[model samples]
Target: MKALIIAATAAASLVSTAALAQQAAPQNPGPVIPGVCTYYNARLLAQSSAGQAVETRMQQLAQEVQGELQPYATAIQTEATALQSGGASIPADQLNQRRQALQQRAQEAQQLEATRENELRYTLGTQRQKITEAVSPILTALYQEKGCGLLLDRESVFMMNPAMDLTDVAIQRLNAALPTLTFNRMPVPAQ
Candidate 1:
């Protein structure tokens, strides 16, 4: 009847309005912001300076470790020479004992070297963490000040216009904000 047709039309109109309302809802545009993308490699800066300091420290530590092991090295060499020569007249048990002692000493040296390596690695990791922590705030400040949207690693970039290279500015700002080289000589723990 007429009522049934009117009801059908009203339902259709409500459905159409619901569809339109759904379509009209706002949607995210995906990271929309007005800013330039700049490449920044924080590790490169930390490594460049800290690497030199680590190398110097390692060299000194190596010399000290070597000096400590010099006597053991000489003793091992002497025992091996004795085994090779007529000193073989020495008892087999004694010879085996000497050889085992030499092996143990070598093993000790290896362990010491490993320990030093671990220490160096720990130092490097800690230093890098410290530098990153210190630089993060600086980078944030710069990013906010400049209204930068994204900061990418320089290494990841294939090619970019010179205008996109804010690395130099970042580096300069970081270096200027950092304490002097002498101050960086000490190891900094993670914050």
Candidate 2:
């Protein structure tokens, strides 16, 4: 009976100690330093004035190039089909001429596609640079205002607090800072 009483008292003391330790444990007060990190969705930033304008022009250029290339595509296919079916009875001179023509046509189509791709790529590059230049200062100001130690693209994060997102606010500031971008010229790369 005495042993049982001692065991029960020891168990009660252990329970009280555990309860005290739990009460003394620190709470999770979110981040060590609030607003130390922030995230923004880049795609969401595309709704800005400069970004919207760039996107519209990019779409228009794509449609225009596709329209221009359609006829050439058809012509090349027709020429290829004709060459395949025309037997050796077709005069050697005529055959050579047709072959040369097909070669030239195919080259023209490739060159056109390559040129259009380069042009669009250059335009998009310039548009991005212009917007970045405009948005940088404004974004820095925002980061300071929000007490952000680090800012990152939301896509890079596994999960984040909604309060740490700065995309909408950044877009508004960027639009006001730069409403439009001159995009056609390729900027010279630094050596």
Candidate 3:
């Protein structure tokens, strides 16, 4: 049994060694195609100065919304405190009515919060679309200048020549084009 265990251990070690060697071997990516290029759109958007500005603005808007909602939150806390502290002295009918009123207020607060969230989402989505639109021309210009006929997202390709990466150049062009974006919370449409 001991001899069998030793053989099994040796076999496992050999298998693992072979697997590691295969993983470490450099893959032979074929020669670059002349008209094909790739760019990481997500990286371009996330790392650009304009994108950072938008994120900062979004955080400011969230803080503003929280400020606007603070009074409602305070009111809810006050009402809950009153109920918890003085419930035994109150008549049962009056207590029920107060509880119902509190529930109603809470529900209204939630609805208002949801509306605010929707507004933020709408604003952010519209802003992102605008950013994409602004980037489109830059991307087109880069592709044309590079003599590229095919543009692929970097995420779509497993491996490519470093020269084919257009992300950094695109970001530079994007920064030159749009330094910062100005936006506000768009009103949620009636639903």
Which predicted model would earn the best lDDT?
A: 3
Off by over 4 Å in 2: 1-33, 182-191
* RMSD (CA, Å), each prediction: 23.0, 20.7, 13.8
Instruction: In model 3, state the lDDT of residue 187.
Output: 97
What is the clash tally of candidate 3? Answer: 0
Better of 2 and 3 by lDDT: 3
> Better model by lDDT, 1 or 2?
2
User: After best superposition, candidate 3 residue 30: deviation in angstroms?
Assistant: 7.2
Estimate the TM-score for candidate 1. Answer: 0.62
Whole-structure CA lDDT of model 2: 0.68
lDDT of candidate 3 over 93-128, digit per residue (tens): 999999999999999998988888788877777877
- Which ranges in model 1 have alpha carbons more than 4 Å from their true place? 1-34, 42-78, 85-87, 180-191
lDDT of predicted model 3: 0.79
For model 1, residues 32-111, the per-residue Cα lDDT tens digits are: 33576665453334333443343355445445556766776787778678777945587989878877887887888777
Tell me the TM-score of each prediction against the true structure. Answer: 0.62, 0.71, 0.77
Candidates 1 and 3, the one with greater TM-score: 3
lDDT of 2 by residue, 1-191 (tens): 22323533554564465446547645642443466555443443356888778767766666676788889999999988888898476898999999998999999998887766666666666777777888788778889998987787755654445567677788887878888765453434445
